[model samples]
Target: MQPDDIDWNIINILRESHQNNNSLARELGISEGTVRQRIKKLKEVGILKIRASINPDVLENQQLATIAINIGESSQLEAKAKEIAQLPGVLNVSITSGRYDLFVELLTFSNKGLVKFLTQELSTIQGITSTESFLMLKSYNRYV
Candidate 1:
């Protein structure tokens, strides 16, 4: 989905206050009705999707990790990314440039559960040459 500048500006403001159309309108120097209309159009055109993001720290027995992976082959990148996307505990996967072929984000209930996902579920997929997992200790300025 492609979002224009105004849409992006609206998005930036909305990220701070998803529920306050009046505040968004004030920030954008537009009317609340216009802000509402733009948001509706954005959602209808599939340029935007609104969802709630739960902070893992608020809950007990929860953990978040990011895994950078290097693949064995270029041809298998898309399929490998898709396979890893379906693995348990995996929240999102992206094929990236530079140092890593794929970046996978995951959340698990416990450290042992994360280990099982890394060793068992991730091992099930081939052509993954290496993986480096980083556990999130804390986050500053996280955007929803």
Candidate 2:
């Protein structure tokens, strides 16, 4: 679906603040019903999602890491990524172009948890040629 000017405005406003339909309508100079309908349509088309976000660094015992993975065969890239995404602690899996075929973001309990995920969970997946993990020590303005 093509997002028109009003839709883009709504998205921009939503990014700044997830206000109620009445407030959004007031700010955008539109009716509350219009705001509700637009928001519903945007969500239905996968263009918008409203959810709470928290910084992982503030969470106790939680550690964030990114793993660069090389798939043995190009044909298996998508399948392997899908499989990996279902694993525990995997926050996101992206197919990319570079030295690695996929980049996986993980949120483990601690350093030991990260180790376990690498050695136990990730290692069990076939077609994964190699992986390089980068554990995030500190982050600024990072929320997921």
Candidate 3:
């Protein structure tokens, strides 16, 4: 659904305070049910998605890795990316241009887990010709 001024206001208010629907109602001078209805509508029409954010460094043994994959068949890029996207720890998968056919970002909570994900899981997928992995040393900023 296209967002109007009220929808934008409601979205901003929720971004500032995600848990307080009543507070949003107060701020917007509307009923709590109205806030709930609008948010429901937003979600129903694929306008908004809510997720909790985590810092990988704060979690013990948790780390982020990006994998660049070169596929033999360009026609199978989307199918291959979809298969990779279904794997455990996958955060995002994208079909891209240039030398790489697909880029995948995933989180691993242990050294062995990363190894298994790369060697055991990734190796099982067909059409992948070569792979390069980059593990993040540190994360400074994240913007949504």
Candidate 4:
């Protein structure tokens, strides 16, 4: 199925439950093959990903923190961000347009683990000038 042929009802159905392809197709009055084809095309074009994501809060030993890092050189932004993304606890990284050069979401099992990550790992990165961290105390809305 082509992008233009994709109905909003199909999108709604998919959003509601991507796993239930046959149910979605039946509700939208289309064949399951059509839904599968569209989903495949969407995945091919980098529009969709069906992957499981864990909630860190569910894991009692884990802690999540958002750390904003200021960089010394704009030229090293991409390379530095990529390096930070590879760090053990680093879950997500984004280069943003603000006072900080990059924002990183990290997860660690203990205070020592997080401190080791920030002081030993993150501090050694070439372009990083400063880091400000905010520990997530509580969450009102956890869904991504």
Candidate 5:
């Protein structure tokens, strides 16, 4: 379903801060029921999700890293990305252009855990020709 102007406005407000139906309705000059229904429809259609995110840097013993991967077969990029997404500690996976076929973000308990993931878990996936990992040193205004 396509979102109308009202829906977009609702989304924009929600993006900045969590608002109840009454507040959204008052701000948008719409009825509370309309605001409620629109939010429901937006979520049902997978266009919107409401959840809290935390900065990984603030978490104790947690580390973040990104891996640039080159696979043997370009045709299998999507399949490989999906497979990698299911692995533990994997946060995000994407098929990309440039020197790599896939870019993956991972979250682990420590640097050692990251090594275990690279050596033990990721080693099981075939067709990955090579991977270069970068441990995140610092981030600003980043949340996961």
Candidate 6:
């Protein structure tokens, strides 16, 4: 189904409660079968994901950081960024239109782990001129 055709109310229900499909159906005035089918469809189309959203910091042995990297040459930017994106602890990487060449978000087990990623792993990659890291102080209103 197209984006316009899908009922976002189902997603709202999903965000509120995952286990109670019947409750969602009752609240939305749809059948359980319909909810399941729509959810399945959404998943298939990459529009909706239903899973446990965890706070990485609260979980033992998890670390999260945002790293900004500057590249010397503009031409080699995409290639170098792709190479860095493959490294462990990298959750998501983006090549943005900004002063920084690249932005990388990471999650790891410890400070040492992240240090290894920044120092040994990323530093060794060609075209990397400078690096800046920002440790998250607090995350607010993050919705799944």
Which has the better lDDT: candidate 4, or candidate 6? 4
Which pairs clash in the backbone of model 6? none
- lDDT per residue as tens, model 5, 14-127: 988888999999999999999989999999999998888778898898888999999999999999999999999898999998989999999898899988999999999999
Q: Which stretches of candidate 5 lie over 4 Å from their true place?
A: none
lDDT-best of 1 and 2: 2
What does the lDDT read for residue 129 in candidate 3? 95
Model 2: residue 52 alpha-carbon error in angstroms: 1.1
Give RMSD to native, each candidate.
2.8, 1.4, 2.2, 2.9, 1.7, 3.1
In candidate 5, list every pair of residues with a backbone clash.
none
lDDT of each: 0.86, 0.93, 0.85, 0.79, 0.92, 0.79
Deviation in angstroms for 60 in model 2?
1.7
lDDT of 3 by residue, 1-144 (tens): 699887899888766656677888898898989889898999899888777777787778887888999999988988999999999899999999898888999899777878999988988998899999888878876421
Q: In what order do the candidates fall by lDDT, top score first? A: 2, 5, 1, 3, 4, 6
lDDT of 1 by residue, 21-121 (tens): 88888877889998889889999998777888777877778888899999999999999999899988788999999999999999987788789898889
- Candidate 2's C-alpha runs over 4 A off are none
The candidate maximizing TM-score is 2
Q: How many collisions per candidate?
A: 0, 0, 0, 0, 0, 0
Of 1 and 2, which scores higher on TM-score? 2
Instruction: List the lowest-lDDT window of 10 residues for candidate 2.
Output: 49-58
Off by over 4 Å in 1: 20-37
lDDT of 5 at 61: 84
Task: Name the 10 consecutive residues with the lowest summed lDDT in model 3.
Answer: 135-144
Instruction: Give the 10-residue window scoring lowest on summed lDDT in candidate 1.
Output: 135-144
Off by over 4 Å in 3: none
TM-score of each: 0.76, 0.91, 0.85, 0.80, 0.88, 0.73
